[model samples]
Target: MSGAATLLLDAGNTRLKWALQQGAVRLHQGVADYADLSAWQAGLAALPAPAKAVGCNVAGPARAAALAALLAPLPIVWLQAAAEQGGLRNHYREPARLGADRWAALLGARRHHTGDTVVVMAGTAMTVDALSREGDFLGGIIVPGFRLMRAALAQGTADLGLPEGDAVDFPRSTGEAIVNGALLALTGAILQMQQRLSQRTGRTATVLLSGGDADVLAPQLQAALAVPLIAVDNLVLDGLAQLGAGDMPEQDA
Candidate 1:
């Protein structure tokens, strides 16, 4: 089994992602929507049988049970955050309460960058976590994502129906205003977190942007960043891969 591939999954609120990793190298990667278990099943069938399958799930217990059933005899272990893992310290008041996705993302970030870091994952919810120069996960903030924010506007307001709009500084139309506003709010939150990290550490933090919306937010994020900004993919999977084979301990082991 030493040389066998390990299946890595990142189960978030909106999607299920997988990576087939053998040792330090990733052999394949893919994603599927939650509504389509058949798609995930087909995708899994096409891959090499992994020696071990591990994942981090935050989509709730019922989903985890369903996914576990889907994997069947293979038996998948869902990972959760610890006070510390892969050398990244979890400083959350309740360390175990930290989302596994965020924990895995931080672990992935540790491999991606050294120095102080501001980790951003933009998906169903956008999370911006701060890491100190010494590898302390100094917690983060979560905000409604671009689509969620826009949806909230549509749901909350009578006049602003959901319409396609581009992110622009000056919005001549209402749709443009909503779209631009969401992007600005998201990008602004990232910048603010980076600045806060820099202020506290006395050294500027590198920004590692990940998740589904990395491409959507990267251009604007890069435009406003003063420090290094790396747009990484599959951070959760990277963390899971780094994790190798493990269980979500009742407490940090």
Candidate 2:
């Protein structure tokens, strides 16, 4: 696996991200909406043959099958949540019940940090997972992401539609109010979890933010928490690369 490139796919709820990696170096990376299967397939087809293709899919069986169809002739190892892998433990009562995306993100965080860390993935849904200094999975919290939050409010009410505005301190308009409120909710959740992790472990926690919306939320979270926040791109793909390199054991054949 030293000089060979591996294909890594992270089939998330709203987007499908793929990367061609040679060891730790990414040669190519691309993303497409889940609805645009053709575009994703074309992107994969354009890449050179990889040594191995590995993926973690939380988009259900239909999307999984669609991905399989696109990577014809090349076998893909679709990863799943297991009891333990890549020096990280799964604390879920039913280990397999944990989302593959979240599990992979946890493993990704462990690869980069050795201390108590909180991983926040802001995508279609926001997930905040805690990992102890010794790489123990401390479970996590899940909440509706910004888009869903806004959609819920808009769809649930007649006049209040999905607002178009950035998050502000004192929102004067309806759109601004909705956006700011959602941002606060997300940031507040991360801050609360960070505080909880510190109290429970007696050590300050490092925050790792990832996913499509991370860029938008990181600054707000960092400003609100008044602490450094690290944003990593395609964390799920990083973990998948680890699995491909045999750094982590595969789960759910």
Candidate 3:
């Protein structure tokens, strides 16, 4: 597979992550949303060579089908763990029940950090999955993401509101109260998970944060969690690209 050209896409709930690469070395990387694909195409058309694409979609079949249609002329590979490739053994009760986004994140986690590592993705949904040194998928936790938490509080409770600014500290106003609480809970959950992982594994695991809200959440989480938190903004796409290249060991289908 060395000389074969490749393109990787992580069509997540909020955005599209695309990358063109030769093995592990990326040539070009771009991001877009559903409305931004036309621009993505224009950018792709400007590239120099023929390429096959590998993608992981978490927005269900409709968006996946539309994405396939958009990349019709080129070879687009939808990601799935096969008996032959796409590393990281899935230990979910039902392997197929795992979310593609989580799978992609785990793959990236395993690729980026060796030894015991905890992959914490703070996106529309917060997910923390632990992987052992030898690549075992040890299970995970999921919680409402920050925005969802804010929305839920606003809709479900009286006197709760959404904040106008990005600050996630103590607030004097209703909106700020809601936002600050959400941030506290979000960061607290991540810190607790990191502590739990450390206690259980007896190995200090690296805490990695990704997804759209990572930058906003990282500082708070870092302040609280104390362990060094590495932010790899394009984790999903990087994992997709790495898996597509057959860079890691093969796994069960």
Instruction: Name the 10 consecutive residues with the lowest summed lDDT in model 3.
Output: 244-253
Relative to the unseen true structure, what is the C-alpha lDDT of residue 138 in candidate 3, on a scale of 0 to 100? 72
Better by lDDT, candidate 2 or 1: 1
TM-score of each: 0.94, 0.94, 0.88
| lDDT of candidate model 3 versus the reference | 0.75
Please give the range of 10 consecutive residues that has the lowest summed lDDT in model 2: 244-253
In model 2, the Cα lDDT at residue 210 comes to 96
**Between candidates 1 and 3, which one is better according to TM-score?**
1
Better of 1 and 3 by lDDT: 1
- Count: clashes, candidate 3: 2
Evaluated with lDDT, which candidate comes out highest?
A: 1
lDDT for model 1, on a 0 to 1 scale? Answer: 0.86
Clashing pairs in 3: 82-253, 83-253
Ranking by lDDT: 1, 2, 3
Candidate 3, residues 1-70, lDDT tens digits: the string is 3686677788778778778888767788877878867888778888856456777788788888777777
lDDT of 2 at 111: 75
RMSD of each: 2.3, 1.7, 3.2
